[model samples]
Target: MAYLFSGDGGDSDSAVVPLVCLQPFPLLLFASVPVCFILSAALVMMMKVPAFCYWFGCLFCAGMSAEMKAMAMTILYVCCISFLSFSLCIISLLWVFCSVFSAFFLCFFWVLLIVRDCLVFVWGAKIQSETCSLDSP
Candidate 1:
């Protein structure tokens, strides 16, 4: 999560340690966007309700944050609205707007959990490898 990444101890040893590149991790998350989109889109194709669409929209937002470009971010916003529209239709069908909103909040929480764990794993591995390299030399 951005919070964990911005936390105090995260960058403490960076004076001596190397920072990882931004390319591939963002790309990997980018590649996953289509899959999420397709799955949510499929739910729409199947005429399922809005909750699924909302959840997928959150995923799409999380993916877009990985991109550094303003244009890509704009495209992501458009995609989000499309997905939300479908989700809203579903919510209307079931007459459960409150429940759908709660689930949407929970989806965001999980996305944060995923981002935090991934950063911890990646930075921890890098630090371990650097320590090993120094010790071996």
Candidate 2:
């Protein structure tokens, strides 16, 4: 039977088994970024601060995750409307410069966050050793 031979056909959807599937830590940590961003946005909104940056970051994480899963078409489908809204702002000349600057800042922050999370994972033992050394010193 096809089911017996293919073992449920789960692999049909995924072109390749993800690196995340191999090492669970990175996947779990990466997936949590969106949740953190969303929660931070909620907190900021509660405190009456602007929450756009946090929301943008959450969207970026979701988009990136979709892209990572070899779903470029899906990402395009979902993010197209948001991208059009941004383009309209640029076209209408409403806070165009500010939008560009904010986009750059968000990109920088995302890079930093990813590096921080990855470094925390990669050099965890080294960080612990250094912290212990500092405390003793």
Candidate 3:
């Protein structure tokens, strides 16, 4: 696990750094915060559409024998309910997919940031040691 953060040479000192310290707060903030806002906006937009019940009622209630009208209305009611439920299910699934994708990228961005910091730290230490050695001779 630590090796993932430590650069090429596998330094034990780098491995000693706690995993918790490497967690990047900015990645989580950047990934989830905007997604939450966007999801809320989308939910609001979804809710603003007029309900299908009124439209279905009006369309299915006209011009038929009483028995035929009853039967047709029942079928239309079921169909409209099914279509609305299916659309809701699809929207729910899409929200879940977007959240999961954001989480994945959050972890990815955190790891990249940690690895970058480790590399810079290692390079700076190397430069300092080289300059010290040159001065000693």
Candidate 4:
């Protein structure tokens, strides 16, 4: 029993179903984004569990299925989790990078460029000091 509206500005007691509920790809896809993110974050944290217990759960799945449906489902779940977590993490990092870059570009970017130029002038050239001479071989 769902509410259906009539365009005549009147309430009609008719069961007029909307097309969205029938073909829900767009809605489902929108819903899956947050669902996958939450489940993937949980799955990532669950990786801290001991391998012995994790393998035991997987072996239990193997024993439960003749066609390997249970095992396949578990593997699929793991793969989806890994994919979602990595993708969301990457997207968030990129978003942060873009936000920071935009903020700098909006303000203080010229100051940073000036500082870099002053450093270059004093040091003669930009140098790679990643290891700070600790990893020199």
Best by lDDT: 3
Q: In model 3, how large is the Cα lDDT of residue 135?
A: 98
Clash totals, every prediction:
4, 0, 0, 0
Question: Please, what are the lDDT tens digits per residue for candidate 2 over residues 1-137?
Answer: 11111122345422233333334444444565566556545443433423333444545535455335345434543454455455444444534454565557656655665675566567988988889999994
Residue 96 shift from truth in candidate 2, angstroms: 1.0
Model 4: ten consecutive residues of lowest lDDT: 6-15
Over 87-131, each residue of candidate 1 has an lDDT whose tens digit, in order, gives 556544444444454456556655765687678889999999999
Error of 3 at 121 (Å): 0.9
Candidate 4 has which clashing residue pairs, if any? Answer: none
Give the TM-score ranking, best first. 3, 4, 1, 2
- Between candidates 1 and 2, the one scoring higher on lDDT is 1
lDDT of all predictions: 0.52, 0.48, 0.58, 0.55
State the lDDT at 90 in candidate 1. 53
Each model's Cα RMSD = 22.1, 25.1, 10.1, 25.7
Highest TM-score: give the candidate number: 3
lDDT of 2: 0.48
Q: Where does candidate 3 stray beyond 4 Å? A: 1-63
Q: For candidate 4, write residues 19-131 as lDDT tens digits.
A: 45433444454565687678777665655443433454666653454456545556666876778867777666665665565556534644554565576556653244544
